[model samples]
Target chain A: MRALRLYLVQRVTAAIMAPLVFLHLGLILYAVQGGLSAGEILSRTQGSFFWAFIYGLFVLCASFHVSIGLTNILQEWTSLKRIAAANIAHTFGMGVMILGFRAVYAVVF
Target chain B: MTTTHKVSIWRGGAEGDYAHYDVPARESQTVLDVVTYVQRHLDPTLTYRFACRVGMCGSCAMTVNGVPRWTCRTHVSKVTGGGELKIGPLANMPVIKDLACDMTEFFEKWQKAQSRFIPTKTRKNPMEPIKPDTPARVAANAGIECINCGVCYAACDTVRWNADYLGPAALNRAWTLANDERDGGWADRLKAVSDHGGCHSCRSHQSCEAHCPNQLNPAASIAGLKRLSTSAYLKGELK
Candidate 1:
């Protein structure tokens, strides 16, 4: 892909992830402060399709964000360019997505 | 009481060190004069670059006290104020010799950014009439005076960090060309600048603007390229 497209994707994904990150952090703080148990958290999350969808979108956006950032870092620091570096970044993002989705599924469904 | 100002000049190649010299101070002495004194009287073998002895030619640029500046135009009193002065080759470039850097990469990136003016009409055709009051003409005129001295390129941190990144001078050239209504290469030029190592790599540190001897704002030029490239992408012209 051309760099402009990559640049756009990175920016768009970052925008999507920003609010999601804040929401996730807020949820963690709220659950811990409220002394909510795993069972209580599960009871609140498991039956809600809204929670599943939001978390799913979060996982995708986070994956793209992390991967694009890593790709930029690797390209700047090393001699890697174009396809090889991008492929490595995509593999890393895929790994993040797989793990992230699995964890979200365990919590949501 | 010291009668002479202590000057440290970088000698030799990348692995070398700074050699100290005491230069006799004078009223309104320029950095180039100090370098000339050191070369002619102190060290016969010292190497540097200069031409015109004035600011017209942009050949004699070097690092003076950590800032890239034209040696010809920068006065000793203005920079050092009757104190010690450190002079070296420009930053973010390979030092070829004492106080001289190879500008191959600098010019190469100019080519990469497609900075050349692409004329749409053949020489046989009549000259295209362009009104100077047009916004595009005025914008093109704003940045057309760059003499390619490489000072802005040396001052750019992005170039130092990312080897492939096109520095300020090239981007500024591209911006001027992009604004030229007579230039028939906007599509290709925009594509070139939108590449991985192009205008998007700039972090807007503004070092290029800060160090420009001509007072030209390469940061603004790069910003213009960013806006143009983003719009082109939105319009599907950059796909």
Candidate 2:
């Protein structure tokens, strides 16, 4: 049941990440090619709902995906059993979300 | 031409190491040929299993140099390194003796996965013709060629980790039954396969796909099962 939940979560996050990944890559290329400075980019991103929502969703999906994937690796490679691996994965997911939201807030709000 | 190859045969049970023997190699020599040479001439006690010299019987599978292959068809040139060969029992299984694994658990998982084909009609009922190109039949065709060689079972790391996890062949068999139009036990089979140690337990490492002797893709079949189970769950069809 835990494995199923993780698989579902990973699939859901992957679906979200698919488009977000392309959009993120496109934005990076567009920004770099347009010769936008770090400060200018930050200013444009600041107080923007669009940028905040997009980046926030991306971060959530990414965190969930990475956490699930890492949990599998830890369970397979290390001595961590199911419950311990799951707890560690949840903790890591929380860390990603908190840190990610903070960085998004720093830029957006 | 009396040609020879230096072969190392595993001599004991799970606790055994490789013992070296120089055997006369023949044209189109197979790994089974090397083992037979060692047992017949060099040592009389070397143990292995093979019925058909051809690949049809699915009985002569072993690990040749860390790769699971059918010993009858696997030529010496394909696996031997520096004229040295190491043959061992299939991994992820209890070695009953030299090169023969305890396939009880292996076949038992097949039963657990409900791999048997259940008929929906009797002799009085008219025959239902199945189209070869139908979507479900096509999907079944992609995975139905398994000869029960245990090659994929040996190659699967998920089975190694979780003993209850249904390995590739069993899951592949389940997928075929799930896609069969005439099979009445689809729901029951899916329920049996969707639990913690079933299709959901697969890590998608694809080692089974890599090592299948018939070159069948069990990974794709398992993915199909995952999709089927998820869809069944959404429709409240999964028991």
Candidate 3:
């Protein structure tokens, strides 16, 4: 994608991630403050479709935002051609998203 | 009151170094005066460009002590607090000779940004009158006094990092024309600015605003372009 599409999508993904970030932080604080163990947290998340969807969407947005940002940085800071940079960034994003979704699944299921 | 001013000027092309000269400082001596003196008396081989030594013409812009500025308007007393001056060609441009950097790429990018004022009316048609107080016109008027000095171009980190990025002056010019109500052709111009090397590359460093001799805020102009481009994209008008 050209910078036009990439720039717009990066911004959109950032907006989507804002609330997700707050929710994740709030969950962490609540869990720690309440002295909840990993098993206890997993008990609440297990078989919960709502938690799965929210975390799944977070992983997707995070991957897309990271990929777009890295593409811009590679273009500006390196001698890599635009196509090569985009290809590398997309590959990296896909790898990261796969790992992130695996973690989300482990915690939820 | 006749102390000597030590000036270091760049010599030759890209591989040049500073050549020092001890010029006699006078009251209200501009940096342009020191350069002219070196070329005239100290070393005739010295070369620099200047016009309208009163600062109207911006051809005399050079890196004075690591900052890009109009040498014609810069006073020796103000810059040389250490009694020494270091002058070189403007940054972010290939040096042609001594102090004059090649400006071809700069002008080419300026044109590429499509800053032209394309009118919808010809001489046969009546001129369309625009109100001065309109917000768009006021925004246009804010950035209309650019002198094409290339200082903003030199100071822009975006242009330095992204080779194809159209520097501040061109985008500023585009913003001014984008606001002009009488200029009918905006679709093409808007597309031109949305390219990979267009206004999106700016990191809002504000270096262009800091170094512009005319006190123009190219950062704000670029922000304006960003807003317009985003709006156009939302409306499905820009591709």
Candidate 4:
């Protein structure tokens, strides 16, 4: 069933994000060893394929996870039906992915 | 000195109101005893349901001061430190009268989860030998004592939120069957539980575990089903 597939996708995205979140936090601490300078942060991330891929994957997973969570919340809380909730969540996910990847591109490119 | 405590009980249907009475609280008097006193001495029209006076049958479950519990086992002195008792029907179901909830939907969800055991062998065959300590049997043994009391159903937020969700008890029954080695139908059962409104809907609130009088962990059983669903999804076994 589609519900089963989506549930699995939600779980997998959560699993993917767990370690990435820790890594991102660790990066924050490591980067802030000096003052919180945008230039230094961008200098470290700029033109780095590793940083690009890591943040890119993090953004993708977050987009997927948050969308499914929103779908569940909308179904439970709002008057919207299942299909309507999924549609809204999908659009929301697209927005998240677009904004997130744009930020990733700005930092990595 | 005999102390009379205030007892408030819900009367009528979904549009019900709590009726108050003064009941003499006795030493080791169960909540069921309080209800019995109200019915026998105070109000003859007050309605409730119970089977065993002792704790065996779970028919006496009610919301005692907001917590779902088996009234037969819950003593007034243990629960009522404030010297007050508030009793009502089990939640998340249609109240038949006062303390009784219609269990039709509760059992219907059990059927919806495909909880029936599929026999691999008929009566003509000898009994299949299943070892006691095996992992499957151990897992099956963990959740087999459910008495269909519907307490966990009353406590579940997922069941309250998702109309389609097969609540804790049904999925717990499915888990026991899934671990049954002799059952040749777990494949179908697996797919059934993996479908929409099945095991995937549980949010791991553990309210079922917290409220179950039988000490069964439907939450753990649901987690097991989720793991199976994930493995099956990855293997392309479930589509």
For each prediction in turn, the share of the native Cα contacts (below 8 Å between chains A and B) that it retains comes to 0.56, 0.40, 0.60, 0.72
What is every candidate's C-alpha DockQ against the true complex, given to 2 decimals? 0.45, 0.39, 0.57, 0.76
lDDT of 4 by residue, B1-239 (tens): 88887999999988889999999868888999999999999999988889987767778899999999999998888888966899999998999998988989999989988898889899999988899999989999999998888899999998889988999999999999989988888888888899889999999999999989989999999999998888888898887
User: Which residue pairs collide, candidate 3?
Assistant: none
lDDT of 2 by residue, B82-186 (tens): 458888899999998888889999999998988889989888999999999999999999998898999999999888877678899999999998889888888
Expressed as tens digits, the lDDT of each residue in B64-149 for candidate 3 is: 99899999999988888866899999999999999989999999998899888898888999877789999999999999889899
Q: Report the lDDT of model 3 for residue B68.
A: 94
By DockQ: ranked, best first? 4, 3, 1, 2
Candidate 3 structure quality by residue, lDDT tens digits, A1-109: 1667777888899999999999989988888886878788899899988999999999999999999888888988899998888899999999989999998899888
Assess candidate 4 and give its lDDT.
0.91
Model 4 residue B227 CA deviation in Å: 1.5
Candidate 2 off by > 4 Å: A34-36
User: B137, model 2: CA deviation in Å?
Assistant: 2.2
Compared with the true structure, what per-residue lDDT tens digits does model 4 show for residues A32-107? 8887988999999999999999999989998999899999999987878999998999899999999999999999
Q: Which of the two, 1 or 2, has more TM-score?
A: 2
lDDT digits (tens) for residues A63-106 of candidate 2:
89988887776776778897798789879988999999999999
The per-model lDDT (C-alpha) reads 0.89, 0.87, 0.90, 0.91
**Residue-level lDDT for B236 in candidate 1:** 75
Error of 4 at A73 (Å): 1.3
What does TM-score give for chain A of every model? 0.88, 0.89, 0.92, 0.96
Q: What is the lDDT of residue B216 in candidate 3?
A: 90
Kindly list the per-residue Cα lDDT of model 1 for residues B1-239, writing each as its tens digit.
53787999999999899999999888788999999999999999999999997787888999999899999999999999667999999988899999989999999999999999999999899988889999878888888889888999998888987888989999999999998988998888888899978998888999988889888999999999988998888987777
